[model samples]
Target chain A: MDYFLVSFFLIQYIRTSLQTAVNHPEWEKRLVFARYFSIAWIATFYIAEEPFWTNWVWDIFLVWLIVVIYRNEVFNSLRTTAQTVMPFVAISIIRDFVKGIFPKFYEENDSFFQVAVAFAFVLCFFVWFYARKQMKVLQKEREDRLREEQASRAQKESLEYLVNERTQELTMQKEELQRTIEELKSTQNQLIQSEKMASLGELTAGIAHEIQNPLNFVNNFSEVSAELCTELEEEIEKSELAEEDKDYIKQIIADLNQNQQKITHHGKRADSIVKGMLQHSRLSSGEKEPVEINALADEYMRLAYHGLRAKDKEFNAALVTDFDDTIGKVNVLPQDLGRVFLNLFTNAFYAVAEKKRKLAAEGFSSDYKPEVKISTKKFANKLYIRVTDNGTGMPEHVKAKIFQPFFTTKPTGQGTGLGLSMSYDIITNGHGGVLDVESIPGERTEFRITIPVSEPISQS
Target chain B: MKILVVDDEEDVKSLFEQKFRKEIRSGQFQFSFSFSGEEALTYLAAHPSEVVMILSDINMPGMSGIELLKTIRRDHPSAPPQVMMITAYGDSANHDQAMQLGADDFLTKPVNFVELKEKLLTIL
Candidate 1:
């Protein structure tokens, strides 16, 4: 009976140890060794006929092995083990106490005690099974939650990357569209300007023709009348008349002569203006010829100066020129280049004249001497022409648009606004040159033209 | 020398008459006036070989001086009268066209009477 009792206890210990090894695969080897040790201790107990204290020592050793196996969850595993074994342990102690108290009754009901022990073992097995099922459910829930979080984080990262990529593509497309729009706008402006120039040319030609005919009549008639007056004076001198009457007739003829002179002077002025208009209307032949740049520049400078003076008698500005003598002649379209120079000179004079007028209005004209300067230089296969003016210079905004067609600082009807724009085209497109302007507000303004000396001029 | 003056402006007749008064009085040159290119053509047809020179103004109504010169060159290739073109526009295009069409001379207005007189004397 004693061997059976020890064997039943050893079987229970081995089953629990194997259950722990199965539950924790990582602790399998240690748990298996513990099972063997428990079995060996039970064998020692039987072979040595050890006292009951030896059985207690083996039970403590088995509990210590369980504690070691569940080291990370020692208290939880201890409580679970206690819950599983407590009923069995309490039932065994009660049986031992009953047997001691009533030896004859315990012997008569030994079978009942065996049934109670088996019932306790079944209860402990159910408790252990329930606790393992609860642990499995908890572990499964935690793993599912972690997987879901990882999947959502990956999706969010992918979505963010897609958004950034789309934003970059949109920005690039917007920039391209803006560039195309700017190109279209510039092309449209160029077309409008060319059309305007064409119509203006025709108008100028018609007006010049009509005005030149009448101007010719005025000039010829005045000249003829002046000659007739001289002939009449000779006739009156030869005639026999009173000295006082002769003097009176002579004074009348003199006044008439002076009147004809004035008419002739104004008529010639009108003639020149008409010629200038015709020149403007004439189309360029697009022929490059060798021309003295200095002489051409000087002529246009005088023309621009006289043109301004004719409009405003009081308008005057000092004109200075520094020509590069070594640059004797350069190949260029003379008329087109002359037009560029005339435009630049006219703009310079206008700037200085405006400044002078403003200063005069402010009573500061006495100290201010309005000046326009033009200079030329030659350096290593390039020619430079600069026109500078001491005037009310332009601000940044105004200077930026000065070369745009129809952009002008002058009041309406005073400027056509095409002078500089056309000049810029002629120098750059026609002659393969560069035109640039620099200005400081309230100080000075300068326009510089750079052209390759030996560049073969294209017919633009 | 008989010179036919062709112009659109009617006032041109009086102006020319006055300007060449001395020459007209002295009979050194005889001047015939026509207000249009058609009238000049008619005059030339009526008095063929009588008119020695045509001082024609370009840019006239109905027929331009270039057309007139072309017509004269074609009609009287053997004995084409001297045709001088006068224009307000002294552009090289017209000048070159006139010269190419057998124009005797090209002059720009306002015409210098002194230079014209000298040129006429040289022609004479």
Candidate 2:
């Protein structure tokens, strides 16, 4: 029986020590010492048949637990270390007390204790295995949750990047759309301006055609009448008329000649105006030809004045020109440049006419003379032409948008609203020049045209 | 010399007669008046040998001056009578086309009668 007890205790000690070593690898040497001590005490309890030495087993196991706690440093706080060690110490002391009191009963029920120990060992092994499986499941769930969180964060970042890119793209597209709208507006204005010019040209061309026939007849009849008058005078001289009668015939012939001269002069003036209108209406041939700039400006200025006079018999203004004769011949499309000058002159005349009418209405006859002055200069490889009117000058607002197409301040039918805009285009865009305006309210308005001396490298 | 004045305007006939009244009275020249191109053609056909010169306006009723010129050039290809074209439009295109159609001279109105008389003397 004692050998059986010795063998059983030795096996339990070896198994427990092996479990400790397996649970904590750093406690391997200490657990081995504890195993030998347990075996020696169990052998003493069995061989000496004494209960006192068996009490040493509980005390030695308590010491071994302390050694495990110190060597592993498993508990971070003293209270936790005490809590972990106190349970085993209490159970071991109780077991030692029971053994001390039931020494004789222990010897008789040794198989009962061995059966309880074996059952306890089986229960502990089962509990340890179940706990290990539960811990593995929990660890796997946490890892999966972490992976899911990281993937979602990455997805959120990608979505944010895509949204930012879309916003930038939209902003860029909006800017492009704005630019396109601006370009379209400019193109539309140009088209409207061209259309207006085209129809006006067609209308003027028809009128010119109709008027030329009558003008030709008037000129022809005047020449014929003048010739007949001379012939009649010669006949009177040959017929031996009285001195008084001859003198009367000569006087009548001279008067007739003067009337014919007036008719011829006015007819030529009308013809020139018709020609100017035709020139304005016709399409520019875009052929560069030599032009006398100052002479051309003066001619158009006179024509504009005469044109207004034909319309309003009472309308008159002082016309002045300071021409630079040195600007003899510049290469330009004569019809186009002529149209520009005609438009400027007409505007000046209209402004002066308006001011004159106003002054006449107010009855302020203190010599508020309406005057238009044209001047030209050539310097620094450029030709500068200026047209000034001392009439009702434009305000700041009117001067600001004077070049925009279809923007006009004149009473509806009196202006086509395209004169200055077309003139601006002709000088600036067509000739690669600059058109500038300087005006003061109720004082004066001046339009300046600056053209480069050299021709542009490209036509378009 | 016999000359034919073809014009749509009736006054041109009297004007021409009045202008050359001295020459006509002296028997230096003879003038025939036709109101239209077809009338001029008919006159020419009736007195082909009598008509030495034809002055026609390019813009006219019935047959145009260009057509008349072409017809004269085509039918009388050999030693044809001199034909001069007159137009109110001074555009070069019409002048060129008229000259191309075998007109002897081109003039734009209002015609210079003195220059025309000089040209007529040269031609005769």
Candidate 3:
């Protein structure tokens, strides 16, 4: 009986210790020492012929060791340990009950008790094996759930990264599309403006042709009438008339002569206007010629001044010119360059004239001499032409939009608004030159044109 | 010298006559007038070699001055009359076309009569 008890206790100890070792690997060595010590203790108790009750003491110590090793899981460990020892405890109770009920039967069938104890041990071992299998199933389920969570987190992070990359690409494409749209809008505007200019040019050409013929007649007849008046005076002097009559005829002739002079003056003005219109309507001929630049500049300056004078007879400004004698000739589109010079000179003269008018109106008596100055200089490979005027200069906003088509400061019907813009195009696009402007409001404004002195190789 | 002045305007004849009255009265020169390029061409065909110079306006009815100039150059190649092309449009294109079509001179309108007389005398 004692040996059976010792064997059952030893099996329980080994099973519990292995379970504890699995739960806490850091206690594995301690558990191994405890196992060997219990075995030695059981052997010593057996060899010394100690009482069977002493084995109970060793079982209690093993339970205490399990409690110490699984401190936080003491109740769970105790339950498992109890399950391991339950069958043995139940078999012992059944044996004691049977022995108490029939003392002689129990004394004669001692081997039956031993067989019953062995059967209980086999059943306990099977129960422990089944429980261990269940634990392994629960552990596998936990590991699978943890692995699935990690995989899902990784997938979520990658999805976020992809979303960010796509968003960045979309933003860049949107910006590029916006820029292209702006470019398209500007190009469309330019097309519309050029179309308008083309139609205007055609209309001007027709008007110029229709007007020039009659203008020629007016000019011719006026001069012929003036000559006839002179001849009539000569005839009247030779006539035998009273001195008062001769003087009266002479005075009439003089008045007629004055009228004829006025007619001729205005007619010439109208003729020049027609000429300017023809020049404007006739686009550049795309022919480059070696022209005397100084002579061209001087001619346009006088033309601009006279054009203005014809309108407002009292309007006058001092015209100053500093021509570069060294710049003898330049290969350029003479008509186009001449148009640019005329536009600059006209703008300068108009500015000074405006300032002069304003000063006179305000009765500002200061010696504010409204002046328009033109200067030409020749550098190594470039020719610079500057037109400066001390006049009512523009502010920042006006200067900013000066080169834009149809942006004009002059009153309606007085300005076509295309002069400076067309001049800008002629200087930059037509001649491959630079046109720059600088101004101080209420003080002065200067426009500078820089062009290559030599003919471009492509033209040659 | 007999010069033919071609124009679409009818008043041109009177203007020329009055402007050159001294020359005409003195019998220094004679001026004839044609209202259109076709009429000028017909006059030239009828009075071949009689005209010393032909002053034709470029923009006229029935036929253009350039076309008339081409015809004159083609038909009277040996001793074609001096043809001067007058245009209101003083553009280089017209000038170039007139020059290319054998025009002796090209003038822009509101013609300076003084300059025209000098040119006529030089040509004669």
Best by TM-score: 1
Residues A167-279, model 2: lDDT tens digits: 99999999999999976775676567667767777988999978977887787777777778888888888987899989998999999988988898898899887877666
**Which window of 10 residues has the lowest lDDT sum in candidate 1 chain A?**
A1-10
**C-alpha DockQ for predicted model 1:** 0.59
* TM-score for candidate 3, residues paired by index: 0.53
What interface-residue Cα RMSD does candidate 3 give after superposition? 0.9
lDDT per residue as tens, model 1, A1-460: 2323433443454446456556756555654565566677768877888655564564456345444535656234355565466566556666666766887898999999878978876777677677668768987998999999999999999999999999999999999999999767755665566567679889998998788788889889999999999999999999999999999999999999999999999999988988878876777888888888889899899989999999999988898999998887889888898899888888888888888888888887898888888899989889999999998999999998999977778765566678899899999999999999999988899999998988533323
Off by over 4 Å in 1: A1-194, A288-292, A298-320, A324-332, A342-372, A378-384, A388-460, B73-80
True contacts kept of 1: 0.91
True C-alpha contacts between chains kept, each model in order? 0.91, 0.27, 0.82
DockQ of each: 0.59, 0.35, 0.60
Q: After superposition, how far is residue A75 of candidate 1 from its true place, in Å?
A: 42
lDDT of each model, Cα atoms only? 0.82, 0.78, 0.82
Please identify which of the two predictions, 1 or 3, would achieve the higher DockQ against the true structure: 3
The sequence of per-residue lDDT tens digits that candidate 3 reaches over residues A331-403 is: 8888998889889999999899888888889999378898999999988789899999999999999999999
Task: Pick the DockQ winner.
Answer: 3
